[model samples]
Target: MGIKSFQGARKHQQAGEEIPLKVSDYMTTKLITFKPDQSVEEVIDSLINNKISGGPVVNDKNELVGIISEGDCIKHISDSRYYNMPMDDDRIENRMVKNVETIDGNMNIFDAANKFLNEKRRRFPIVEAGKLVGQISQKDILKATMKLKSQNWKK
Candidate 1:
């Protein structure tokens, strides 16, 4: 789904009391991704350039291998400084979360929101057929919930 779909969903939801919203309706389809073999410096640059906290680590085939976040990157800074090595020496594969928790695009938004609350994660990679497709973030959930609340108020 795209931005238009999200708007449609929002409008439809506003017109009714209950309209089921799925992750696909709110998840971001455009993504900035990383590769496992990529240098930490490059990853950091990409993340910063994209104005994102992190991104999914995908293989050449676009398969989800891991996830990298600011938290993971922060944990390596001291070590790199102590070792007197460039951040480029660190590979994202070594720093990324290998056992990443992923969500399906068709998943219920409420379910995804619960996962965000319980896991305390900022974002989740949307996996379909073992490939990274999109992402959903805590901010996205917050926006969606706020929209829902506003729609409720219109009734």
Candidate 2:
């Protein structure tokens, strides 16, 4: 599939109409998170149960440390020689990653678009003071884009 674009979606279009865009505007604050110590099995369950690819991996202090994705889990499985599946692995600590890409909660939509383009991730964990606050998916940006386009077209 071709990569999506969020070029103009990032900027707030002030065409005599309200353009909806903000972390608080679209972010799901009550979203679930993962623990770095959580088992791979648990990560699988969370992914299935929550119906999401992955989530922010938080430290003991509930701070965003890294992100876990289905792709990450799959990488471990596809590369692993272990006979045991997720059960054999506990809490995905070893599999869980650390160097996560994050964004400030107060970051403008435009900034997020830039990060998304360069970072090459589907979603970003919103962090403030090193704490995990929320997350935004590509879907959010698409919604904002459509809203802006529709609003601008109406004028």
Q: What lDDT would each prediction earn against the true structure?
A: 0.84, 0.74
Model number with the top lDDT: 1
Candidate 1 residue lDDT tens string, 84-110: 878778899999999988888888788
Q: Write the per-residue lDDT of candidate 2 for residues 67-94, one digit (tens) a residue.
A: 8889888877775647555455545667
> Evaluated with TM-score, which candidate comes out highest?
1
Q: Which TM-score value belongs to model 1?
A: 0.81
lDDT of 1: 0.84
What are the root-mean-square deviations of the candidates from the true structure over C-alphas? 8.6, 7.6
Model 2 misplaced stretches (Cα beyond 4 Å): 1-18, 82-87, 153-155
What clash count goes with each model? 0, 6
